[model samples]
Target: MNIETIISKIKNALGEGVDKVSDEVEKSQVFEKFEDSDDKVAKILDDAGKALTSLFDTIADKAEPMIKKTKAKIYEGIFEEYRKDGSPYGETHEGFMQWVDEHETEIREKVDDGITKTRETILSGVKKTQEYINREVSKKEKPSDSVVDGSSVTDQKSSDKE
Candidate 1:
């Protein structure tokens, strides 16, 4: 039914029946060999995992300060310059507000001029558009009794007279 029984029967048929102690010894040796190899594989894997973890940790620890320093440098270069010089605008919020106050009249004049010009241009365009629409509507509304079915207003009138 099982491998051991089959082996035993075959051995017995060959007149070399297996001893129980010998079978047990062989099974124990094979089991121990398997266990030893398994332990070895587990140790190797554990060591490899620890080494990889340590490598990544070391890389992260070394890179953190450099990354922070780079970010600080970039911020300093861009924002610090703007804070100092205030290019086309102003340096700070108060400075920007003061600049706007100083130029308030000029800004208002330019905006008013732009709006007036835009309004005049739009009014002229609208007048021209309305004239074109009116011409088209009048043409369609005016009656010319030129019949599409080969009869005219004069022909119908003459027929009625008859």
Candidate 2:
């Protein structure tokens, strides 16, 4: 049954058995128990939340440099597209670096979008990883008697000859 019903039953059982205190005292006691339970749950949730936030902050900090490096690599490829043609058509190294510096917002959005898409794709594959492994394992053929368990190939071959 629900928590409230269970608490009510407990309160009733307490009221029927106890004679020293009145109904108000029993209820107050039950309420106090509930408050104590709620406080414990809240504390646990608060601690978990803090830990999760810290983990995310740590991941973001570690990812920041890697993200900038990837963005620069992408920018270089884009810069190369214009450079292959030569002259004013392609951006000079300084011009390309300036462009990257100036378009920070756009670059960040693109990088974030790439990260989100990559995460989604990876998670989708991860969910099926166990199933894929199980399927492949099941499809494998069993070993013959000549290939005894724990025996080396040379030993198995000699035993087979015998």
Report lDDT (CA) for all predictions. Answer: 0.64, 0.67
lDDT of 2 by residue, 1-162 (tens): 865666667656878654544445555565666576446656776899999999989989999998898878876655664465343433567766666676668767876887799899979897799789778877895334443233342434556788
lDDT per residue (tens digit) for residues 21-120 in model 1: 3665565453454476446656776899999999989989998998798657654554444455454465665765565576568656765776689679
Write down the worst ten-residue block by lDDT for model 1.
144-153
- Estimate the Cα RMSD of every predicted model relative to the unseen true structure: 34.1, 16.6
Worst 10 residues of 2 by lDDT: 142-151
| Backbone clashes in model 1, listed as residue pairs | none
Winner by TM-score? 2
Clash pairs for candidate 2: none
Clashes of each: 0, 0
